[model samples]
Target: MLFVTRSLPSPIWLNGLEALKVTGSKGKGSTSAMIAAILRQLGISTGLYTSPHLLKANERIRIGDRLISDGEMDASLEWMLALRDSYESRHSNDNFGAFEVLTGAALYHFFNQRPETIVCEAGIGGRYDSTRVIPGRITALTSVELEHTELLGNSAELIAYDKADLCPDGGTLVAGKLEDALLPRLRAYCALRSITFVEAAAEISELKYNSAMMQFKMSCAGIDYGTIETGLVGKHQARNAAVAIQAVWHWLQCSKREVEEQRFTRAVREAFKAVRWPGRFERIAEDPETIIDVGHTQLSLHAVAETVREMNSAKPIMLVTGVSYDKNVRGILDELLPIATEVICTRAYHKGSPVETVAALCEAIRRGIVWKSADTIEEAMDLAVSRAREQNMTVLVAGGLFLATEAFVHLSGGDPRLLQFF
Candidate 1:
């Protein structure tokens, strides 16, 4: 089960690469970004590698907040692809996919850059995620759930066990809250592996949020930080911040780096203010107050709905949603349909569940609620804006990351790749 094949000079590719692997069904991206931000603020050069880029492949790799340059990407991809071709020539049975190639390239970039720290987010369930190939010093799990049932497992505890497998032997594992049923499984796994398990949520309290920012206090890992403020919205984000703080603190300890109290506190404050992970409760418009959230899961959608309700009291909320075919559409709609003034369902400018199917699903769960179907996301946005102006409602573009990414590009008028010119 080697990721970097021996045919590709594995020693040069893997040696001296230490990482913090964060994996779960949700919040992995934001949590990794938060850790990278805090590390950078503490004056450590950091490399962050995430997945499912919104616009460009280069978005998956970064060094100190700068995406890998096109020149660097070209060079790395060329080298990796050549290695893949050579390896396949000899061993046809084993091959690499696009994600594997990209993951290797990101690791190469990080190794070359020699960042003091690297934060890697798993593309899927963590037991065998490509990011696990890195010599991770600390592992962080961000609220696991029953996802990737075919690959991970069918139950919550099974899924937790799969993610728990990512914790390196003798390495520290930090995690947020989990289902009560999964705790025993996690405890058993950690005890078997002799991994240090720290529950981050236990140290989190007084999580309060407004439209602009969330405020919370965290006292964890022999480091007590009071009244932390983050620009990331929602109560879940506060928990995520706590997880990031604990994970990074553990990394600091393992690396034997001293954290000056005043400087570290200031770094936490500045990191939250500067942290910018897009497509989660993002505001795209001002007049009608259009917002976008990539919360396809029921729990995440519930949090999004709660945040939107608290933010918009004067105006009714209209939902423009497009979800993937593989998602639990009924579960998500069941949580969100009742909160919207009207629902406009459509497909993003990418491959997904057809807009017609999504519309029908919405209709079944509408329960006399107002709803309509649009052929494309553009048309859906148009209809939503027109209706919002007519009815004095706010527009919430949600349900899937593809839809949210499309909305971000469309609203910003920044990327031509998302423009579907059919």
Candidate 2:
């Protein structure tokens, strides 16, 4: 359905957001949730708005770790429903779509509660995403990669421009370290707009113990905020944390010099643990140590493969996988196959993929990888785990989120916990 946001009145709830943060890229959902969790620990009422809910649509909007009450959601829905005609008329009978309606609903919830902060995940490309309409007191970009090419753009430069679109006047703009190709465009854009630019890489050094997280003091506007550890899996997470920490402290100056380095560090540590962003390389079941990652791009896949190898478990690794029509599956497999002991390909379109074609491709690329295919996600998962059981091996389930995650939950008795975070 058409869920229009612009035609609707700006809710009074928008006024309460002392700090507004937006997370971009594949990790947007997890990163945004983590930001909210940290603010909540400091006893600030925080609202979160994310998209493409896994199991239920209600999961899209949350306040302080809980889904909004049904009554509140329904009331908001009714209001949007009533305002539909006016929005359509304004757009020459065109109305807001699904994303806009939910975003408006979330602002309605957060603003009325007058939460200490709001953490938002950009649904599509940054520039045109419904969330961009909100004036972010602080904006953070996750590592941008090629995504939604038809809607956003085909090149990294185009995508970067789309991401930089969220940099409204007077808003502090934080960018995930731009890829070599996108960096020049992003920098130029920031200069043209006079947006306060914060690059994730310039801060924290990677922590020695876990190559995964980085510990660094965030210095903004001559203020130094103390260090905190990020538990996000990839080396990229260190970058994501840098963007988040900077944004948090940047907004801190909005009121009091209340948070110094020490307190800020402490709050971030608690926030990292409290943030239970799921699916991105999560070892949800450790007995067989099953892994689920939603790494759809070549860069993301490379990151996942590197981390799995770093885990250094003696257990021989077996991979369960899937992908999209546009994804570089052959290229991703080039990075993924070296570490895997065997490969099981599953058709995963949700609607499904061509199982045999996927299997054939896997076999051709890695001649002796024991490549095989299954008719459905469940069957493919069963085959992978069953083989792992026989070999006492480890299973890393990944491909597209639609393929690996759905399969992992189905074989694990279809648990609801899978959707709660990832």
Candidate 3:
């Protein structure tokens, strides 16, 4: 509907508020960050907005790598509350969900700042996600994964349909190897919508990431090409970079006349290393080389499992995991169980599935492992972490990001600033 609700007194009209929306199951945060960083390097004022802030609510809004100030957040939130009241009064519709409110604030901030480009990350699904309200030049899918099954659907193809629904008349879709199950549906959607679809080429040969900064040189199929050296961890990250870089490169050719080739490559790489995303397989603490990946969906799980194998020579591992009620407990447990030596299951304390189902699934499929639960996440993770870090082991806090978020804060000694406390 209206990204800027009538009641919302949409941010003051501005000039050159170009937008790019990044939507998909995984890597949306990193992809959006990469795009924004690239645009910023090109000497353009860029605004980057992502959701459910891993570090702080402010992380959801940024003009560049710099976050919006507390004073700015307060002002924006106030404006949004007023808009919510008016929206309820006039149409009696809650167009702005909790996420929508933050998104609107970001748009307002960007609009006011008049950035040359704005890269927006969708909150949930693509079609009706709060961020979809804004018009974007190009739509990029990091990689589709089945998430929010109750809200999206049961199958991977169904999830693709929801995400594909966002490609409007003139917009183009940049994708990195759509999952086999979702390919047919995505093609049908693209054909029906009469939109251009570009499948970004992945260097499948680069099995395991080597070198602190390895150069990935691949040409996008049927599109102008560029290579990027991404420091972001995991093999999946290279694909994410390719998808984002292709989107930026394609968007450049579409919107502008002819641009210098050097400028294009430099823009994409100038802020390469400075783009920081905290909890995507981040090594928060290294005493035991314990890594934290807030990967929830199946695609993300596979990435985490693969990264673990890469790090420890495919060693068997112990995992501390919890998931939201909306995820497929069986699918998640199945994907991870093969790589797991022990699975300590816990519930996110959220409304989705119960911890009992997760625990039950593990015992049935996994051999020689104790399935345990905790009344609270703390108790569950406390037991899980204590067990995993003994020796020659890596403890993975996966499932829900909230599980990783909570563990991070608690392990750092109940630091309230973990939210902003770090």
Please tell me which predicted candidate would have the highest TM-score against the true structure. Answer: 1
lDDT of 1 by residue, 1-422 (tens): 25353434446535555678898888898999999999999998889999877777888899997999999999888878887787789898989877788887886677567787689998878777877777776999998876789999998888887887887789888988788777777888888999998888637677676665677777765677777777788777877888898888888888888998878878987898789887778776877788888776877887788776655467788899888788887787777887888888888766568877877778888755646788877677878888998899889988887787776676676552444412
Model 3 agreement with the true structure over 309-362: per-residue lDDT tens digits = 765545346677767776666777777777777777776544336677777777
Candidate 3 global lDDT: 0.71
User: What is candidate 3's CA lDDT for residue 136?
Assistant: 64
Cα-lDDT of candidate 2: 0.69
lDDT of each prediction vs. the true structure?
A: 0.80, 0.69, 0.71
In model 2, the clashing pairs are: 3-96, 3-97, 4-96, 13-111, 226-261, 286-289
TM-score of each candidate structure, all chains considered together: 0.93, 0.86, 0.87
**Candidate 2: 10-residue stretch with minimal lDDT:** 205-214
The positional error of residue 25 in candidate 3, measured at the CA in angstroms, is 1.9
Candidate with better lDDT, 1 vs 3: 1
Show where candidate 3 strays beyond 4 Å: 1-16, 93-95, 153-155, 180-185, 207-217, 221-229, 312-316, 349-356, 371-375, 380-389, 415-422
